[model samples]
Target: MKFIPFYLIFTLLIFVQACGNKQVEENKTQREQVIAVHDEVMPKMGQLKSLEKAALQKAEELQNSETPDQAKIDELKNLASQLNLAYEGMFVWMRQYNTEDGEKTPEEVKVYLDEQLVLVSKVNEDIKAALAKAEVLLKD
Candidate 1:
């Protein structure tokens, strides 16, 4: 009877340890997924800055011209604003990122990462749109 109880305890302990290890592995995977999305989008930040600068210059030139095209200037201004917002969103997301809460678990990390993937996808799309719009405007 004593051996049976000890065996049950040992089995339970092993099961608990295995569960913990699985959670740790899951957390690592979730973290990697989040970082992957971030890495994919971060390199585009420089391009966004360049586009913003070009848009600003173009807008300034239009304003200084004898017959400024108000409509074009407004479009460029809007593009600049959107680019700024996209950059700001990335910066804010990085600053606010935290998955190490005391009460949080690996499941929570997975949930957070899943949500972040959607947000990062949208940010990338916005960056692409801004780049395309800026390119067409700068060409003219």
Candidate 2:
């Protein structure tokens, strides 16, 4: 009778350990899938950022030119399009920054996102300043 109780206790312990391992494995698999998806997405955002930078360059060139030409206008329009796309990506990232987001690490993701916020702010301010200066040029 004494042996029976000990045997039952040991069996219960083994069952619990098996269940815990299964749960851990399942969690790991889910995390992997999420990371795989985010890996593909981050690069696309990077491309958009590149385009946005090119657009900003175009606007700056136009501002420095003695006379605003047709080419300047065309470049501005192209820059605006790239800026819009980049802004879209920024908004999407902001929306997901708080959630699990399938990101690599929550802490690392926050750092990346905070840096992006600063960059985006600077880009927006540049666009505003450019527009203001361009308006003055157009008036004169």
lDDT of 1 by residue, 2-90 (tens): 79999999999999989878987877887787778778779989988888988989999999999999999999999898888888878
Model 1: lDDT to the true structure: 0.82
lDDT of 2: 0.56
Specify the highest-lDDT model's number.
1
TM-score of each: 0.81, 0.43
The lDDT for every candidate, in the order shown, is 0.82, 0.56
Show where candidate 1 strays beyond 4 Å.
Answer: 99-103
Which residue pairs in candidate 1 collide?
Answer: none
For residues 15-119, what per-residue lDDT tens digits would candidate 2 score against the true structure? 988876675565456545444444434445544555556556666777778886777667566655645654474566446544443644444544555555554
Top-scoring candidate (TM-score): 1
Q: Tell me the lDDT of model 2 at 111.
A: 53
